[model samples]
Target chain A: MHALQQKIREEGIVLSEQVLKVDAFLNHQIDPQLMHAIGAEFARRFEGTGVTKIVTLEASGIAPAVMTGLIMGVPVIFARKHASLTLTEHLLVAEVYSFTKQHNSMVAISPRHLGADDHVLIIDDFLANGRAAQALISIIQQAGATLAGLGIVIEKSFQAGRAELDAQGYRVESLARVSSLASGRVTFLD
Target chain B: MHALQQKIREEGIVLSEQVLKVDAFLNHQIDPQLMHAIGAEFARRFEGTGVTKIVTLEASGIAPAVMTGLIMGVPVIFARKHASLTLTEHLLVAEVYSFTKQHNSMVAISPRHLGADDHVLIIDDFLANGRAAQALISIIQQAGATLAGLGIVIEKSFQAGRAELDAQGYRVESLARVSSLASGRVTFLD
Candidate 1:
């Protein structure tokens, strides 16, 4: 966690009061060691939580989720942003609005992958407005699976993502919490 | 590699003469241990190739790429299929046509992540038409980076992807090679 926070402070670019770019090590390009550390940290944090499956959104979340899945000895299911020829049956679907990209996309997972007996842990790269997390949660619910918790790499604490999830009685664990991105700088939460 | 071949034969769904869906493990829901084995296999095959970085496309490729990157102790760079707010400067771009999705998407990577001194190993989930590999190769060339080889999880030998890359004199290592997918059955190339 310290390493991630350090990496964010060293390489994270603050575009504005609301935007932080971590494309150097995360987002676009990934630091494998950092991801491994993140996976271990998530495994350590969520230890003994009965996590049967790891769920995430496609692209950015795959690396961390797979790493966590590897350490936790669980299968990882990534929700597809677009419809694929291979994925066209028994889908649990949800609509996600990306505040960053400013577009709404459908996120779906096949019900065949998830079931009522599974305890699903949702993992992702960034938690800003929590729209993506909410979408994954909805899909998990649709499958009649139990929610283990939500794990995040970097969280924008200034956003309503954490607060909303907390109000819903869902446990949210973020490795790096950014308190603010004011004046082209990153401020971590304690 | 035998394990991978076994998984394909058991869980892989042969949709048609051209399409074989491994969404049960490789595409949609990922088996972490199998990916670990794959990453180790790729690392073993591409060992001593001076692979400074692992390059892959987003969504499906991230799991294997990150695992290989972890074992090889290098950075992993994933090209973005869509434009992002955080990624907008000095990008090396290429257009990739997805035969499966029936669409063209621009794949871009930041110049900051790749350089002339880097030896990039391209990794992907599937090597069907090889358009995605070609796009990544183009992006790597634009950065003046050296390519180590292509590491594919599954390669359709019946397709032109392997032949084209072979004709180009590029090294390719696929864990599992499929000879055909006829009559709803997957036949592997020995």
Candidate 2:
């Protein structure tokens, strides 16, 4: 967590009050060494929850989720944003709204992959509005699976995402939580 | 590689005369254990290549690319399918024709992430028509970066993908090459 926090301080760029660009190491251009450390940290945090599967959304979350899955020795099921021709009809689908994209999209997983007996750990790169995490949680619930917890790399604590998830009775753990972006500086939550 | 071959034999579904679906482990529902092994195999194959970075397209390719990046201890840069508002204006863009989606989509990478001095290894899940791989290669070339090599998890030998890459003088390595998928039977290329 300290390493991630240090990386955030060194490489992270704040474009605006709401935008934190970590493309250099977090999302677009990933730092595998840092990701491996982050994955190990998640595995350590959720050491004994019987996490059978790791769930995440497509695009950005895939990198960290794959690393976490590799460390946890669990299969990672990424919910596809677009249903391709190869995807079957029987699937657990959930609609999510992206605050960044400003649109609604559906994330889906084949029903055959998930079952009632599985325990899932939801992982994502950032938890801004918590829409993506909620959508994944919805899919897990629909599959009759138990939610182990949510692991996030960077979280915007100023946003209502944490409170919303807490209100829903879900445990959320974040490596770095940004409390404020005042005067073009990032302040971490204590 | 034998483990992956066996996984394909057991869990892979032969969709048609030409299409083999490994969604149970590769695409839709990923087996992290197998992916880690596959990642290790890729790392072993590309070891000492001075691979500075692992580049891949969005969606399915992200997982294997990340795994390879983790094993090789390099950064992984994934081209974005859609340009969100968060993306920077300076980018290396390429047009990729998706046969499955029946459309041409533009993939972009921030110019800040890739440079002329970088050695890039392209990784992907499947190699069929090879349009996506070509698009990625073009992007890397446009950035003036060195193309380390192309690594693929599954390659359909019946398709023209390998031939096209070979024509372009690329050292393409596929973990499993399928000669045919006729009547729900998979035959590997020797």
Candidate 3:
């Protein structure tokens, strides 16, 4: 966790009051060592939670999720942002709005992957408005699966994502939480 | 590689004469153990190549690429399919035609990730008409990086992908090579 917070301070580029880009290490270009550490940390936090699957959104979330799955010795099911031709048996679909992309898209999961017997741990790169996490939670519930917990790499606590998710009775764990992203500076939450 | 072949024979679904869906274990819902084996197989194949980075296209390619990067103790950089807000520095873009999606999309990689001094191993889930491989090659060439090799989980040898890439002087290694996929039957090339 220290490595992550340190890396964010060193390599993370804050372009605006609302955006913190850790593209140098976390997303886009990834450091596998850091990813493994992040995964290990997540596993440590949610070790005996009876997690059956590591579920995440596609693209950015795939890396940490896969890494966590590897470390936890579980399977990772990434909900597709776009339903491809092969993903015809999409059992559950939830619409999510992305602050980064500035658009809403339907995220779906195949029934073959998740079911009532499974307990899922949600993983993502960042938590801003918590739209992505909410979508995954929706899919998990729709499949009759249990939401073990949510693991996020970075959480912009200045936003209401954590409060909103907590109010809804979902437990969320983030490696780094930012209390404020004001004046292009990242202030960590104590 | 044998386990991969066995997994294909067992879980892989041949939908059409040209389509083989291994979504059960390869893509959508991933088996991390199998992925680690696939990564280890790739690492074995490209052991002495001095691959500085594992490069891939996002959404599906992240798992195997990340696994390989972890095993090889290197970094992984996946090209972004869509340019998000933070992906403003898309230094290089390549047009890749998806045979499954039936459309061409621009794949971009940040220049900060790859350079002339880096040695890259291209990893992907499938290789059919070689369009994705070609696009990655173009991106690599643009960045002036060295291509160590191409590691594919499955290759449709019946298609022209291998031929095209071979003609272009790129070394490729596929775990399972399907010689044919006719009438929902998968025939592998010995």
Candidate 4:
């Protein structure tokens, strides 16, 4: 967690008061050692939670989720942002709005991968408005699966995402929490 | 490699003569242990090749690429399939056509992540018509980076992907090669 926070401070670019770009290491270009550490940390945090599956959105979420799944010895399921030709029928779909992109995309998962017997842990790269997280939670609910917990690499604490999830009674753990990205600088939450 | 072949035989679904759906492990719902094995195999195959970085497309390619990067002690960069708001200016872009989806998408990467001194190893989930591989190769070329090799998790040998890359004089290593999927049966290329 310290390493991640340090990396964000070192390489994260603050585009605006609301945008932080971690293209140098976290998302576009990744540091595998840091990813492994984050995964280990998540696995440790949820060690006794009996997590049967790790769910995440595609693209950025795959690395951390896969690493967590590897350490936790569970399967990782990534919801597709776009509808695929192969991914049709028995699908659990949820519409998610991306504040950054300013649009809504339907995220879907095959129900065959998730079931009522599964305990699912959600992992992702960034948490901002919590729209994506809510969409994943919706899909998990549709499958009648139990929510183990949510693991996020970076959270924009200035936003209401964490508060909403907390209010909803979901346990969310984030490795690096950015309190502010004011004046082209990053401030971490204590 | 044997384990991968066995997994394909057991869980891989052949939708048609050309399409093999490996959603059970390699993509949508991933088996983390199998992915680790794949990364180890790729690392073993590309050992001591002076690979400074691992490159792949987003979504499916992230897991294996990150695992290989972890073992090989290098950075992993995934080209974004769609244009990102933060990813603007000084971009190396290539247009790639997806055979299964019947669409063309422009893939882009930041020039800050890749450089002339870097040696890149391209990794991907599947190799079919070779368009994606070609696009990645173009990006590497644009950056003046050296191509170490190409590592593919599954190669449809019946298609022109392998032949095209081979013709282009790129060294390609595929963990599992399928010779045919006729009559809904997967035949490995021995």
Order of candidate numbers by lDDT, starting with the best: 4, 1, 3, 2
Query: Per-residue lDDT of B1-190 in model 1, one digit per residue for the tens?
Result: 8999999988998888999999999899999999999999999999998999999999789999999999999999999998887777778999999898898989999999899999999999999999999999999999999999999999999999999999999999999999999888888898
Global CA lDDT of candidate 3, please? 0.90
**lDDT of each model, Cα atoms only?**
0.93, 0.88, 0.90, 0.94
Q: What is the DockQ of each candidate?
A: 0.91, 0.82, 0.86, 0.90
Chain B of candidate 3 achieves a TM-score of 0.98
lDDT of model 4 at position A144:
99
Distance from true location, Cα of B144 in model 3, Å? 1.3
- For residues B74-113, could you state the per-residue lDDT of candidate 2 as single tens digits? 8899999989978958889999998777899999998898
DockQ score for model 4 = 0.90
With a 3 Å backbone cut-off (N, CA, C), the pairs that clash in candidate 2 are none
Model 4 has an lDDT value of 0.94
Candidate 3 lDDT by residue in tens digits, B1-190: 7898889999999989989998898779988889889999999999998999989988788889988998999989998887888888647999999889999999999988899999999999999999998999899999999899899999999899999989878899999999999878888897
Worst window of 10 by summed lDDT in candidate 3 chain B: B82-91
Docking class of 3: high
lDDT tens digits by residue: candidate 1, A1-190: 7999999989999999999998888888999888989999999999999999999998899989999999999999999998888788878999999998889999999999999999999999999999999999999999999998999999999999999999999999999999999989999997
